[model samples]
Target: MSTEQNNIRFSRRNFLRTSALASGGMLVGFNLFTACKPEAKPAVDIANLNFNDFNAFIKIADNGYVTIFSPNPEIGQGVKTAMPMIIAEELDVEWDKVHVAQAKYNKKEYKRQVAGGSQSIRFGWDALRQTGATTKQMLINAAAAKWGVDANTCKASKGIITNANGDTLGYGEVVSEAAALEVPEDVTLKKPSEYTIIGKDALNVDLDNIVTGKPLFGLDYKADGMVYASVLRPPAFGQKLESFDDAETKKVNGVTDVIKFGDKVAVIGSNTWAAMKGKKALKAVWSDDQNLESTVDHNKELIKILDGKEFDTRREDGNVKKAFAEADKVLERTYDSPFLPHNCMEPMNFYANVTAEKIHLVGPIQTPQWTAGRVAQLLKRKEEEIDLEMTRMGGGFGRRLYGDFALEAAEISNLAKKPVKVVFSREDDMTDGIYRPAIKYRIAASIKDGKLTGYHLKEAAINSNMYDLIPNFFPAGCIPNYKVSTKSYKSDITTGAWRAPYTNFLAFAEQTFFDELAEELKKDPVELRLELLQNVKDSTDEKIEYSGERMENTIKLAAEKSNWKEQKEGVFKGFAAYYSHNTHVAEVAEIEMKDGLPVVKKITAAVDCGILINPTGAINQIQGGVLDGIGHAMYGDLSFENGKPSHKNFDTYRLIRMNETPQVDVHFVKNELSPTGLGEPGLPPAGGAVANAIYKALKNRLYKQPFIKELSSKKSEVLS
Candidate 1:
């Protein structure tokens, strides 16, 4: 059960509305914001269901079938299902009778609707609960009034209300009367012990549509008179389009016209095949605008920055110089990781229809509001004139957060004066992607009299440094003498958020460094981390982002469940714990030697994110994060040559094969502190755990990404 501080609180002025549908149904919705009033407009019809302007999130039909609108974008993170589960639990409705729908973007109806940072549940927990509980209370009042009894004498469960006299009424029969009641200022939310839905396993609502080859994804969307377009963008970062010859492209069988905008050329046709074939036949000339950068150049530049004295100090505590000078021994290691592409299963695509009246955009977008604003600006129209709808995404992984492809679609449609859908072949998606930046970290720890005395860390990257909050994450408050600094070298290659962002690679580097520290001190790795956390638990600092007690509990649970100290014939295990995206996670990786190489066999993970919405969905997310981390650390690499990608397709690029995947076991710490992030925290500790396990199997340590290449070559030193 949640504590008093976490209870759902409401005001008498809360906006609650009820409307009688033209089809004889009732609508009930409660918006937390009291200032904004919904516009008086006609009800909209979707699939023959009437939904009013004020009841955007909930509608109860005459037959007792309920529709709940999910206000956030669905990027395969389970938010589309889990968010509605929260509402259904408090509304006391059967899960089978509920229907989930993806909501169109409406600024007045939703807040923080983007799907990134794994924060949908965390931010929506309170308001969603209030929405359902308030509606349920109104229904109870209506039932009690009908029976001439006190409201406390009525009990509501599973869309039915029963009075003390044993008279029962269905929610549909009393919904119209309930809608007329005043908004309840206080309603009790169910305790965790009484929950029948939130913590239980619930199947995805769209499972049937997904498995039956239905049109649910953005790639499956179509419209009347919509033409297909294939674009030819700059092949290299430092090059731009100087001229193009499209006479041959115009001769292709279904090609209609060719248009050029900025540094890209678009070919239009009746179908995708003709558009692509026309693009293949077109020829374009490019001219260099600056120096073409390569992977080798980036490596040299990062190393130079690390070796130089130019730096920006992010954090400092105590006297690191004094502690280092008085230490008995010092160990330093530099770890490197190459750039990575998102590599979404569905390549970049968006549909746009631009006219003098309105702009219609329909596709998979992580940031719908942001994309709507950008599309309006690019077309020089009002934001209110754009209608944006989000489709189910095959995969986002932060790629859809930037609407570059959506902008291209709108631009092409406006230039050609026809509704167009821009599609990118695998090559176009891979070469013109906002990739994860290449980074390197140099860490040094000083030991004095068998105790860790000081720590120093320096980072070098492309484009931007780590965000300001990361410098204060776990070890910052634990270490007495700690310091951190960073440097960056700008490049034309665009970089943005990818999965766990900075902590994804940072965790691997720091956890392995801690393992080396444990060896130097003759202590167990788990014991060393516990001792470090003890300091944080005793500290009085309030600015720290993670809780030491929660992280310690998570680590202990992972170790106990995985039998960290047990020894089997050829089973080697390694443990790692980290805090990121507002959640604490610990992982234990088990490996076995196969033909003189370490092969990961299984992974056990423990997480503490306060509350679990759906165990089935939560477990799937945890397992996916672990496997993604392991696969990327082992084989995911994107290299560059003269401002162009070295590999553009899966033939040259490698991903983890099915045979390489391992079984994952997950455990969650039961608590009621309110839910945090779940989609990303499980991933940060996975890479570090696997790396430590590999070192146990082999005596050598790895300092670079694509660990398979280093293992195959037997490279004992840094590869970059």
Candidate 2:
């Protein structure tokens, strides 16, 4: 439950059922009794939010305020504001009168609560609007009935209903009348040109709250007697805990007790700092099992397995061997990207309080439904006994998807028998983390007379990362006569999604190779990409596969905006394009080599994430994600030595600070299609754009990440 400082439980729930909504529509209970209940069972009715409808309403009381419920968490995407706009616009109600609230977790109803893929707006766009329009029509019918006029002659506007006879009725006055009517089945939707709420720039609803430091994030979550806890895990990947000497840890200030659960030894304390201090004091030993090693040597051994192996084949076209054999020239380049950390601004932390019946969980999470079930299983209880509350994330980037932190917190609370907030220290969080898979890609392109005749991509990476989501990520048929396959070489290291997942490595390799091909063929890179993007758009199909059409669009836009040839001077221009996460993105990077360091001056980015929900927010995501990609490209690396990670904190692990951030210009391709993902699409090109620019400036190719210095043109030059 969201708490303000005043701590007043208003009539938000009670007014939902008994009052009319902004659309002048009454609540339709999935249950017959709740629908007809006389001002009772507000709680039950609140749970039955019709997500399939757009004008979902809880209340419009005599005060002329309408409360809108938003199911998707506002983790910087601004869904908390944009989603309610769908409701308000359809309801024809004043924006200020529409008081919004974070919806309680419900899977059977809210289809878009799974927030990882950047589908919040796409999922909620129609549902919320239809809900509002339906309810509004119903309210108009009720008002017309009360005025004794034809319903067709009645129109609703700004929470008021009027008939041709000049009889006007406010929604508040017609609440009792509207609640008694049967819901309208058919409703008229607003035309695109008629959209007053969507496609317009609106201030984020929580801007003031966020700026004021309201209790919006899980870290800011407070409760009575909330004790902080910290966990000590294995020293390295695949290693298990052998034992721990907790005597000195228990003597630390604010130490309450040391508890052991499975592999972790947690120190419960009064604050996060004390809990971390106590965790550091504990001397623990881990069993170095499974050749517990992370080194270039181990990766070399893994690369051997990748040489000729094959796992699941995503796409296979005309005989790849025959295509390569018939071609005049076939060039193959092997590319690699190392394991990376999520490094969300807020580290993993969750508050859990266990009682005899239920366990309450609060934190930043991508999939609450999945976490809720896992929490129940970890606590050895039913799903109903575990309640998960999701809050705004400081930064998710696919890290909060890990539910182990929540499980640990719940387990500690269950054993210690108190509310425990387990916050992982920066060192602990960095060293012990789920890294982006160490990926290797081999790209082979067959050229015939300055044209790419055939294309084949063979990739090898740790299968353990994104083990479940791989089937869904394989590229669609965008290239003909192409063969694509994957080989898995598992490391004991826990690998998971970071940004665009496999596409991060795939894009780097594919785009880089594609750029190289364009240069060798002496054809314009943008023009070559446009030729490959030729595909027939399907009219009857709902799901369209990739043909790089959107990618072509983005590249054209970026080139036009960035003035590809005439860059206004003082900038070395570089261009890169990538299609991932169902959206296509292209970037033109303006860079300057300053004292042997490549510094970005500006970037013109074009993205197509489908229809714009909040234009400003989508732009913000593209800008932020692009800057993040810039940092990782230039100087972000994580290495291990002697069974321990080399970098643990920001002082060691590098990030692009505010001063280093380039001027990012974000644009969305004008399209009237299904909303695609934006959370990670922009990230894939940041590296390639910078590399391409550097290549142009220095006449050399960059083969590695963290390119702080120029790579020697000599083939055998390398540094430790």
Candidate 3:
């Protein structure tokens, strides 16, 4: 969507609503949703304040204290802090003087309360700025009226308004009068040059609380008379609960009751330990009626689908067949990536109190509105009757986008006739299998006269439910005679978004292919990609999904920062670039072979997400994403045998540890463009860069994921 389409406009009727404060403070609320649209207004209990609305309220006391409510979930991506920073910047308030609070979920009031797709900032950029600017304008207008001067002559800075004569009044002193002033329709937002808070390093609002072990995360939440529950899931995919003997479970100390709902069995107890123990003792039996497919079987099915001619064409530019037939050389290869688990630090958990008339749920979730709608449908209740509260999540990577865990908690609470928190153990979380879809890509490219001629890609996967695995992504617009085809195989294994979705695998495959082509053509990998992007930039197309100039800029910046042309004694460098979520990123990896294994020494990244809201936060996000991508490419994988997961926990599965972490340096291309996404863009290029670097170091191309295993076997072969 264009920026204008995403711009939010507040009606005068709902612009600023004031309520008398007990401490003689001013309470100003800004409704973020459209007032003209009846459906946009959520049914909220004004007296009790029970709703999930995107609206924000500022509480300013006579003591110059300011509190702002952030209206999105904080899943460790730093939205809780970055969002409030945006408001504080436009409000002309000092960072230390402003406090932030989390807002509840109210769908009708909050247009988009989702965290997935890395869209929280992108979607809220204009709306949130307008919110702060509008409030600041009101305060300025009030100060001008008090001083009997024009509003334009008055200036506001650091929570203080000053008149031409040098007379000043604090925001708190004028907040009451500002609350009674009319809100302006078009408030002026500060230009990038005038920003005092944005682009500067600011401590996270929750940093102190986190370090102090405060109760902020969902796992730390508690309630009066609330019990704990643990669920026993099916042993394998396509299985249904047949029978269970809960006699021993109920007899255990602290174990209250055992309830069965469809394929899941829940054991309630006084605490989390008791519930887990009781669940283990339940010993439920399941019936496997459908086809029990394993990872081996799924791989074979994907291969078959790829070999078959039947496919859905997603994009076709030129005559690929003619180009391939007339080319001097045509190279084709297949890349495979296995299904991976999210493994959020805090296992899935949610607390719910479901009664006949209402449902109250509190937990860590990415999509509160979508989950609330699903819960309302399941319980045959109105959405207004359900209060879904979002808590700080230890990590979310997209697993919390599903509402199954919340539904399970609500079901258990309804059956127990009390408030209950459903918790999933590490074993349960790893084995349940809502994983990143295992994917295979058959890529072919034709080279003629040292110039790229044609490119073709065919993607085969288990399902296309969460995100369509597009074959033509980045290089599609850059290369001529390009074609993309897709095929899907049916499977019982559940799959959802994991970080960057399909781009995570596509970047590895496409960028690696580009590196191979560069080697074949005797050209620098970075220069070759820049040439393709240059072609894209010179094109006169009416619309382009990605900006070639931005991509080229980031690529050049990364290359410059990483000293691409210079090489250390034994260090090998590789380069990769990709565009996703409207953000362009380029990364270069430096590696050295130590003890027959490739050790990543350092990584240099350059991102073009337009203006940087928080330089420190953006850098942190890029660093985290780089590490996560490296970890997944090096050690992440999940397999199954006879429809049951082969890996039960971290013992069987592998994850990147602190010892394996590499030093990452991040830089952003300076621009005045509006800010884009940051959460997942930095990840896609990390895998590709590392894979290409390893290939350069060892001269052995690894086409499969979990590069550590493949490298180990290659090392053994070299020794033998």
Candidate 4:
């Protein structure tokens, strides 16, 4: 509301625009209100909360319920549940009184909206607290103004402010009057000890809706006179659109339209089943121009190129060559991981209604604002002319970060000249998905007196789908005398961010190699890591280091919880740990080689993401991440031959089933900061931890991924 603040953040003319947006009572359903507001009494707020330039985050209804517009989304990672809890705690509102909604696009009010790289909480930490406090202060100010009392005499708690005499005013009473006032400046935040809702076990805000099967997902979105459509894409990556004769497809019943579009043919009908039926009727021809595409051969080429050349050095330490020369002995090995599909349960789908001037879209997307801009460009309109509604996603393991389906929907809508919903069939979703890039890594370690003296490592990845993350990682100074080089080979296969991006590869290669070095040095891996990590301080120091204290706590906790030192009856335990996204995690995998098969019996993990936002939710994410990593490392591979993917379905690209999910026990060490990202930080370690466990059980190193397969081979035997 300050003139200087306004001039800096917003244009003079938009002051009216901002005022109208806040007060116009535009009931057309911005979809920020759930598009399901009750017609009757809801105990709405008496005054609106001020957020400076930020959007109206705390919208209180007449019925004493508060709605918070969260910029990020809820794609089963439980943001809808966990994010609001932070506010409800800070704002001192009852859980039952809170109603959370996804925010519309507003560049000034929000940052970190795309929600990948586990940066949600890292960026939201300061901003969200400010969000909650700004709104709370405004409410308190409103109550104070209405009572003709000084603001300092009024205190806000549990959606109400009371004077010294204990006379209270509900938030609904003065919200309208407060909405007319200038938004407050200098809102103060609460002390950590005063937090009541945060750090507490706040159940998911959407739990009831999800459990009761309300319309909480994109697949459930429906409108009147909606038609279903199916896209006929190539069965493999290299295959392309050749001339297709639709004469055989026009005869099918229930088929309405045969629309020819770029790279695909659409079969449209009155119902999903009918569209699917018509799609099956089409007999189209595709050129095998890309028949030579193969992820396997790509992997081989990457390894060859990696061995021949050295690319950019991600990190370098003291005289690596000299250190290697002085070492007593040096050992080297090559490791590989295959391409993996996200295979979200819902598959990729989007609905769009396009016109000459405007477009309306709804779908499960990670970046709603970015999608809107791209859709506008694709539709040849201004970004503001487009209205996008974010729907709950079944899953988004970094697969949906690219809005391919949104673009597809825009194309379908523009062509159909009607509101169209483009749904990728399970088959199309499986084969066409951008998968985790397959990577090839070569590592060399020089050890002396069972103490690591030097290390030289390089990773050659299928660069076509990934870029280097070394600029933002811990390789610079986590340890002494370390050299890490990175090179990427572009591949024909579409690759993208899997769960942890390059961290998965980094963890497997570095941790496994560290284990090997520890064995040679005759030192416990945990103790050895402590020796290296203890000297490095914070990421801001000259030798950028992960917080050694946090890492030590996680390792110590995992060691104790797993009863690490005691020999188990039949299970072999191995430990691996890493820090990412401001969180520290250490894991110990208990394994049993049953029938020569690496059966992960259980896992014990310790994490310190700062103050636990939701203990159960954090634990759930760790367990799920561990299971997902196992699936990727074991039976999952997007094999290709003749320039086409070999595995297109779950039957071919197998996932780790419930039977394979180990008995996971997770513990979070209490710490100082708020919460950091919990969703993805756990994934990088499971693959490495499991690999180390396999190595412990089988002494001979299995340098390849899916170690279970190689170790469990018919003729192969365990090292022990």
Candidate 5:
């Protein structure tokens, strides 16, 4: 096919429009080669092979260097390096010769540009491999044509094409010819046995840049002629802007303008510090007559809702009531987890330059396409007129999934009539909302013949409408009769997706309950879980959300690696296993108690995500997730009083520091199944493991999060 003809057939926009393999969806076959025309001119370098603006994913330059564009955001998950490594493996190129670039948000071109739900690698695995394989075939075909040999007889290795006769051609040498050739409709992919890069311990591409403190994060983004902006949002959830006085703020040095947008007031200045000072000087007043709910009121409302008859039945099987009635005993317990703030290290920040012709936005965001769509709607402009770019995120943990910060920046820039970078101070970010919902779980299990015959879970939350509650959580299908129901109370506090979402709280409640059940039955907790999984494995169901074998394997591996059977003088072990984002994870926590406080010492984790793209990156993700889970479970909590968050900053709202972090060891199960997500699976189980260990050490049950304070209160009451 002529380059022009190929371009028409395989243009990014048309390709994405026609293909069913949208981003974050199941993979489908894509044919890059269909129609062809006679070639026009032969340029020696592929750099000059500008075939009608065809933006092929894999680009070969004249210097034999290859560039691959990663489509997802880099949210400290190591996707930036691991994804391109997949392409390099199939393209048969040396790791050092490959360069990775972050692709901007282009839905029509990239189809789905999102970094949420831990679906980046899962959705990109097949498509990215096919991209590299097809490009390699084109290069091989070009080399074969030059040598007058069959294309099938030419093999590509390390950016070179070789024939049976020992004749060879560098990928750079045949780039022009390759670009003129038609893409292969079907190409062979390398088997795991033949991979040289996929399973290896490849270092992160940005490691050097990060180590040297290079400017790569959204907080470090800067543009020429850009001003700084700080916004003062409503003090309370249901409150609205009443009035603001900016005359005094205008007198502040470097202050430019004070812009108001409904519930927010933005202060623009020559620098970030000045903007913050000017924002404080505005002394905005907000209307507080809406009678917004407080945390204590919400908790009471949740309990009242749980007591009410109204419920949404997510999943139910068999006769739970009958089984409970026939049981020898029924154990009931209620667990609560307080709301939490993401508290991302970098805080929320974004840069925007909105003009009459186009809007330019650059920042750290997990969902770029969604943000672009929102910006287009807000600005009353076409999607094409907005340019969105992503930078490396300091930390996401589901906070970046929302693009409100980016929208605020764009709004401020448009009103200011200049480029503006919206910066959120730590205090502003913490109190500005979008928090993890406070949740309540009431569990009841029927015991018959020393086994669980029936199970019922009733979950109540504030604004459950924001997130879908899963009725069929872990151990759902494993039991004979199971029932799960949910209820919610309405509130104005903004709630959003946190790491592992529902699984985070569910695992803690379910696993800790199981530990209690194990003691009641005089059986080992790990053994009891395995027994339940065995029932799932032996079941005749045609569909199961989680792999029984994978879950069982990880549980066994984690126990074995953590020395679950061993007894230590001062260490107590706790075990937990869960499945989320299509990945199975089992963790064992070793904890010690000192001075009436639980001290976590170490955590051993086993994960089954099928295949590992980069072992080093995988381990890093596991460690980070483990620490985050532990930190939040131990000290994370957000409360409201008088219609506003009582904990305004880190001082009142506790966070786990480095000195409190435990050593983490991670292990991946050996498997051949297609890869799954890694960003969140490692987290759901950590809380349960740590909480269970604390219970073992203290002989006291912790039914609420921010367990440090709970334990302290219990100890004080006992002393009194």
Candidate 6:
């Protein structure tokens, strides 16, 4: 493989559409790679041979190899492999002959290219399928013209086009002719039953590279004469730099220079070790510019907000006061989650070569377009002067969505006037990180005549609150009298999206609260949820975000698959179903008590995300999401002391170990509905399932996150 990487650029011309066709007309175009000069070929091996661009998505080489470009960033969500499979399926090409390449960011050529919210596949489905089908029809038209036959008589499959008389023409034979033909107005897409490539097991495109230790990730990227940088930022969130002394840093061997920008000092050196050593050697002073907050402060403030009358009512249906006043019984519970650092496997790093002429940025970033715009505004340069290339991320989990690291690299290079790659040590990544904000939720339910009649949810969070749509999700339309209120306590500590965002904890709180409500109503946990979903279906409200029918199916499937009602000697099961990212998922966790502690043994998940693409990848996503959810809910916690993180690395922190991981069995609901998002939906319900299972095994209710802590406290209380 070539170590020198090229800037990912696409054709600037818009896709061609004939005026004779209706709106959203068929797209036809020649090689976007050579759109400026059709006679010229790309400077590659295929340049000497015949090749053609099929609707700016696919390319066919004379050797019969097909290349499909995936436009979204690959954040270990399998969109890199799954998106191309959509194109390959409708293109009627064999999977083995197809090659997948990550496309460069070109807003004019692609839409919604960012990799967040697990929406890549959902948004790209129709356009991707249409691209492939249109290209195939154009090729068929070319073959039909060459053979003097009606296009209706031509059948294409496996890169081969056949006329009614059994005359076969390889796609490579007609790709050039297809390039000159007008795009067909309409093309038929194959039924799910007829799919050959989609809904089938396909290995990840980068699997070999990842396993064999190839340079496929941002950390592996390098350029000529690139210098390394290690930066020293404020130790605490509420502190700012007063002054810095870098005399000792300058004397360090291999250290080139030290530059101070904004509130940070960057040590530049010939290599990573020298830069890091220089950073440690430098002396700096910081002054507290604002209140130095701590976890205790956050805890007290969150609870205070929950108790305060000042609130933003997200949704309210009925008189909650009257319902609670006239109720037979009332139950209220509070759940809290601590700040969480993303802690991606690969620390934050980016390469930047900035000059007066242009700026080159190469790294793994989820929001490349947005980052590019931000960099342009920060550096006082035009957006057109920047070129960003995204590499496969080792792990994103919503961390890469922010471009602060990339911006730092660019600014440092601009100051030093040399190509620079800023590397963040594990300590920097953990301490100075954009974290998931600490949130507290209080849920109250009123029971009347042994039925759940009223529900009220209050949210208090740091910096921001949940998305407006969360209040409209499940249990919103189910309850006769429902209300959701939110309050936010602004903190200087930075926080952004973490995996499933609010639902990561919200689902746990809601699902567990439902379990408690079930007990109060003298009902089974699963049955209670089914009953609520039936209420939703019976309602005529069209504003609810979740589908009662789809949610019911997944819950039933999960319960059935896990033998929810069957009593096994040692197995205890807990069930939870949720809708998020436009996908409905239900999960059942099986656990048993060992040495007076609850140990999760297995997790069964039933997902209804419409259609399944690349079953192998889908299962991997589901299992990974489930495990991530379980690990974070049980062990993920970040504490603050004087606005500084308590733990800076894994040694001090905790994570779910390999031996602690449970077996995950994932099943999908059979449907032809267009695919939604699978990356995050599986995660929202996993925590609730596991927490409820632990309750079943221990017969104790745990309301907080990092459940191990609560469980230990419960054990200590019982002993006392």
As for model 3, its CA RMSD to the true structure in angstroms is 4.4
- Looking at model 5, the pairs that clash are 1-36, 2-37
Q: Model 5 off-target regions past 4 Å?
A: 1-56, 294-296, 466-469, 540-543
How well does candidate 3 score on lDDT at residue 282?
Answer: 88
* lDDT winner, 1 or 3: 1
Error of 1 at 173 (Å): 1.4
Full-model lDDT for every candidate: 0.84, 0.70, 0.83, 0.70, 0.80, 0.83
- Candidates' TM-scores? 0.94, 0.88, 0.94, 0.89, 0.92, 0.92
Candidate 6 worst ten-residue window by lDDT: 42-51
Q: Over 4 Å off in model 3, which ranges?
A: 1-54, 293-296, 466-472, 540-543, 715-720
User: Which candidate tops lDDT?
Assistant: 1
Query: Could you report the Cα RMSD, in angstroms, for every candidate shown?
Result: 5.3, 7.5, 4.4, 7.3, 7.8, 8.2
Question: What value of lDDT does candidate 5 attain over all alpha carbons?
Answer: 0.80
Q: What is the lDDT of residue 611 in candidate 6?
A: 84
Query: Residues 327-404, candidate 5, lDDT per residue (tens digit)?
Result: 999999999999888988899999999999999999999878778888999988899999998999999887888889
RMSD of 2: 7.5
lDDT of candidate 1?
0.84
lDDT of 6 by residue, 8-80 (tens): 2223242443221132222243233233224432111110112222224666665557877776789899988
Off by over 4 Å in 6: 1-56, 289-296
Looking at model 1, residue 343 earns an lDDT score of 91
Candidate 5, residue 223: CA error in Å? Answer: 1.4
Error of 5 at 400 (Å): 1.2
Model 2 spans > 4 angstroms off? 1-58, 107-112, 293-298, 464-478, 535-544, 547-549, 567-570, 709-720
